[model samples]
Target: MKKIYLFLLALCWAGVSFGGDFVVIVSKDCPLASVSTTDLKRLYTGKLENIDGTSVSGTNLSMDNPAAVSFLSEIVGMATTDYKSFWLAQQIRGGSTAPAVKKSVSDMISYVKDNANAVGYVPKDAALDGVKAVEVK
Candidate 1:
């Protein structure tokens, strides 16, 4: 019974760690309140620019960050490796530039807080004092 309880506990902890409950955050001054997942995917993939009339500058977390992986795979519809490859091809072809990447969650928050047009994502549990989260539908 004790072994079973411990195993369940470990499973729960793993779920908490890998679960993708990320929120799309932007500067508090941003006019929009929420955005759809489709729109978000478009914005991140460079297929669309600006959300509703507000120019959007997208920021990304480092490639190795789990949140980044989730955002890329779950939200952006691309694996991290494939995403990097796509961006590299775009860059080589003189297409639109990739979003700026921050090394940590704190750095991502700081960048979004400072840039009024910026949009980024962080884990739902992250402290978002200066930024506002846009509901992902």
Candidate 2:
């Protein structure tokens, strides 16, 4: 039992430490070709209203998702707990809510593909048939 627990813990740690790269995606119809991490952080945090003349909305995967954790910590500069606390305070203060949460990568892909103003992130291996991947600098 102890060995099993240790193995599982190592597996989870490996996944977090060496997760696949992720891409920020937007609808193909969106005019912007790419976005910097600064701009992405702004968009996701509701600081930016538009990108390159197109109105933009952001979506996030479930808080517990590994990709979500990576994006929040590496790109958004916040831990999962900190991100949640920030949003919670924003809500209590009657500010804008957090980005809509997608249940899975497929849901995120579908939402970004269908909504011209939407932006989202997914594991780089995920299918990206209709949406455009934005280069992160």
Candidate 3:
């Protein structure tokens, strides 16, 4: 029983540590072509509003999405709970609300398609017809 429990614990940790690839995306009309990790973090945390003179708004998938899990750990360099807590504190301090959350990949993609300033991430192979992948620098 103990061995089974231990194996399950290891499996969950491995899932978080070894999440799949994700790509940041924006509407094809966005002027910016790429973004730095530092700036990407700042944007998500609401410390930034524009990149290279173009106004930008960041969005995230709902907390449960695997792609969001990957984005937080890999690109944002934050654990899920820590990221949630940071946004909670930010709101308590009267700072901006956290980025909007889309409930599904289709919703996220549709949002970016409709909002030219929106930037978001999804599973690497997710359909990206009206959106263009933004290189992470």
Candidate 4:
């Protein structure tokens, strides 16, 4: 029984570590050095249109990706279904749109590289050729 309990605890820890194996990234030239979680949530949910008076955009990976799922759950604080519904509600209220969804992590990185004001999350070890990870508060 003790061994089984230890194994389960280890399994849970592995899951948490695996899910956390990603980074929130932005263009290397982006204005902000770090972002509070509140600001990030606002930016992603479309409640915010700018950061430090500079127009900024958010990008999302398709929820089918484990990185995306983990990002949504841990950082965004929503499951895929809730995130979709929240976006739908925002759209219906006539003011916001969901973040652009990228097909893959590479695509997400490319987006951040090209869009100076864009923010996204990708696997921690993903090649960050033209982008940089921002500290999340």
lDDT of 4 by residue, 1-137 (tens): 99999999988756444347678888988887777777878888887878777788889998888888888887779999999898888888997778999999889998899999898989888888889888776
Please list the C-alpha lDDT of all candidates, in the order they appear. Answer: 0.85, 0.83, 0.88, 0.83
Per-residue error at 13 for model 2, in Å?
A: 25
What's the TM-score of every candidate structure? 0.83, 0.82, 0.84, 0.81
* Top-lDDT candidate index: 3
- The TM-score ranking, best first, is 3, 1, 2, 4
Model 1, global lDDT: 0.85
How much is the lDDT of residue 26 in candidate 2?
89
Residues 1-137 of candidate 1 have per-residue lDDT tens digits of 99999999888765433347677899999997878777888888787788889899778999888888888888788999999999999999999989899999999999899989999999878999899988665
Would you give me the overall lDDT of model 4? 0.83
RMSD of each: 6.4, 8.8, 8.5, 5.7
Between candidates 3 and 4, the lDDT winner: 3
Model 1 is weakest, by summed lDDT over 10 consecutive residues, at 12-21
Q: List the residue pairs that clash in candidate 1.
A: none
